[model samples]
Target: MNKRLYLELENCIGCRSCLAACTQCGGHDERNRNYVYDVNPLVNTQTMPLMCLHCVNPACARSCPAQAIQIHETGAVLSALVEKCIGCQNCTIACPYGIPKFDTEQNLMYKCDLCIDRSKDGIPPMCASVCPTNTLQWLTDEEIERKQKQFNVKNDKWVTSIHLENETNVRVNLPGILQGITKLY
Candidate 1:
């Protein structure tokens, strides 16, 4: 049940395919609603994609006095019960990544579900599926570790960190050449 999403910033080609896919899957109006942030650090040529890290101790979950946020068993998925949300904006302020978006029309908060709906059909997430350079990857923790080790063997840098908040877990890292590239973004 230990799953994670991996981002290879160096491999990223600044494509917005993942962003488009995420918005489309979330809902019809989500296209302009969802976004993939592109940051190019002054020293780095590669672009870094910023999104929800789905922290184990999710600040958003704890901040949500309404208890609208929940993490699935796999630990990679975070969901917001729109019906339960009170539109307090606590989750938005609590989230360090600022991933949760406030829906002005619906008066609710929305963020990435990691495409849980698409997973029901045994499909990879929109971002991963459309990545031409294979920059974004989703895998179980064990699988991620194996790949990390392989990268280490090749003298690649594997920076890993974990944080827990509000009964949610967040694991993040940059691998290989992407490590330095991501920092620039």
Candidate 2:
């Protein structure tokens, strides 16, 4: 199945539109919700949008005593059953990426659903729709693989190897380099 938010960090601008969209999506006030955080690298200025990785084997889902989180059929999106959650925060602690945010006001944990509701209407997520630059594009696994293959052929390099190196290197040189590089969660 197609699952994964393939990010081109080099193309990302420091705009907080994605973050704003995510917060609004999660039913949080503009002031309180920050699903994505902006990071300024020592060398450059770029906003890295942070959100749940929605891993194939999600630590949050495994750790949830209430079994509130479930992966969609596509496997890219994850949703939480707020009613089932007891605000234990086990998912939050289990997540290594720290993408899940705890809303003390609501006494529930919220995270990025990858805008599945919007996707059902065949529209891009709010973040992708509002991105000033065409950096963040949502695509299925097959589409991403095709692009990666094309990129490799054009560059005369191995895309998978580049990705592997990128994944291990926590100290990225460019801004937003770490957007989807880590599988921490």
Candidate 3:
């Protein structure tokens, strides 16, 4: 699909609307898979959302001894299959971004699946749907390209760390400070 999820880090207002909406997604069991973090509590109140980037070659899936973590056709790395998951937690240790969450009681691993029920049908994920600041967005490739060009974002893929940079399905535009621009969409 041409339509995909996009993130504009500078636009997050720390409203936590995305978190609330995440719990409402089907099969989430009232738990939010994504996270919001204070960029710098002492320096500023800037907060950013973090979620599974859905790596092109997901370590989470690779580490699954039971092969429970499956990637959907849309490249969304889905949660561990209940029947197949062995509760080994290997996926958690293997992931670089620390996106997967373990349920101690249920002995299961769960993470953002890009709201497959909705996203697979070309609808926006719950978080993107409720974001008032448009921090999280569902946009077409053309729209993303236009925004990236407008913001002077040379790279559409998210940079996980200095040592390891994996290409991901979800595109991102870094904060203004990192981009050397005062405005970001």
Candidate 4:
């Protein structure tokens, strides 16, 4: 029932467009540190856009002393209120990916709010909307689970990402590349 942001690690061009687009959202105002990049846990070399995972059981919300973090009706976990946020960084410490940020000037915790206004109205978030390679998608819970299962990593913790365009997910597996970091060609 929940919608999630899905990523394709291979499609990332390292363009930083997602980061640029993030600033266009409401309340960003050159201060919100929203979009962030993260490396895959399974593959050290692979990078992906990192945001609030909107966990079913969110540690950030529970740890917020002010209880400023809110869960949108659509299941999106939003950024903490600047007025209510104490800049304690408790959520930052609690987050598995370390995605939360502190704005020293504003003295508030900043994290991706998932473009709450657009998402509720059925529009994709800025990052996903501007992804030229279709590497990011907004998908329902069932769609994400089904796609992830296709990777056959249900037991191995391999995450499914991107447009599902190319079946090949990792580049290091090729025999020639295994010999060295250089391209096989």
Candidate 5:
């Protein structure tokens, strides 16, 4: 198992704390993973977070000319190596999931390293740590199995019936989790 971040898209409230937490300005870790993005889920008044799938066969690593990208043994894909990265954006272009970003001012590329510094000590990533609704999570083996069994939504399509304060009914379609996902009904 790759053992990366897993998101329960239905629970996300679009707070952008995950996005903010990914950035240094949010005041968590100094170096920015800066990978999370928000996208429409074909529904009104809602969005879902997206990030690197950190593929078993990563296009970013294969496409790097500078050989800056490295996949850790724990399956976390690190951001571009500062000394080796030429800021070519090859990884960005080559990524099937479009996870990488080039920083113009810094002249380097950045992506989620799964918070390697923190996770090494068994800490969850800042995004997961800060999520208010537990929308985003990192699952253990037992948790993964439990979620997989409890939730019926597959990777292809996502739906969660929600009723608003005004009793407005909305039907939403989630694209899928970036990596592994499980949810509680």
Candidate 6:
């Protein structure tokens, strides 16, 4: 649990490797839980990976009337339990980053579970392991600190679009253009 997930927006090359790897995760039902987005499709090819930020007090979990979404001991906000899920779609609407997805046919809510099956044992998540550009990284606190210092980044925390109820577990280093902005588009 000492290792944390980290993202460097500038390092991503839009390869989609992380997305491909996500489908192979256990309990994922061959569906990719992560996403890659074009930073600005018209202007540049720079792409960024988007997944659950695993917020400290997740809105998704809070809004679930069935209380299906649970937070793991390792601080990962897990996807909804099939039996507990009520298909209310509250999680999809509550999340600030739009991370959760609802399967209409299956009547379920699914999001990034941070590969708990592997990460609980200190192994890197599948996305981080397959990222050839090192954009998605799994690192210890010490390594994260080193990278922050090396990049001259004052704060490693960032959010996409809007502020969440609290901070997220995952750390992100914004691209140079958005360095001080602290908001990811």
Off by over 4 Å in 4: 31-46, 149-185
As for lDDT, the candidate ahead, 1 or 2, is: 1
The Cα local distance difference test for each model comes to 0.63, 0.57, 0.86, 0.64, 0.64, 0.86
Candidate 6: the clashing residue pairs are none
> What C-alpha lDDT, on a 0 to 100 scale, does residue 175 get in candidate 2?
21
Each candidate's TM vs. the true structure? Answer: 0.76, 0.70, 0.92, 0.73, 0.73, 0.90
Tens-digit lDDT track of model 6 for 22-125: 99999899999999999899997878899998888899999999999999999999999999999999999999889999999999999999999999999999
Spell out the clash pairs found in candidate 4.
7-161, 7-162, 8-161, 8-162
Candidate RMSDs in Å, in order, are: 4.4, 7.1, 2.2, 7.6, 9.3, 3.6
Backbone clash tally (model 5): 0
- Tens-place lDDT digits, model 3, residues 2-83: 5778888888999999999999999898999999999899998889999988888899999999999999998889999999
| Candidate 6 ranges with C-alpha deviation above 4 Å | 156-162, 178-185
Task: Give the Cα RMSD of candidate 5.
Answer: 9.3
Q: Is candidate 1 or 4 superior in TM-score?
A: 1
Error of 4 at 48 (Å): 2.6
- Residue-level lDDT of model 2, residues 1-185, one tens digit each, is 43344555566567777766755553334433334444657856655655555566777888889888887765543556868878889988887777677778877777776676665454666666777765556666666657655444432232222342223111112222322343221
Could you tell me the lDDT of residue 35 within candidate 1?
A: 58
Q: Which stretches of candidate 2 lie over 4 Å from their true place?
A: 1-4, 23-34, 41-43, 76-79, 153-185
Clashing residue pairs, candidate 5?
none
Ranking by lDDT: 3, 6, 5, 4, 1, 2
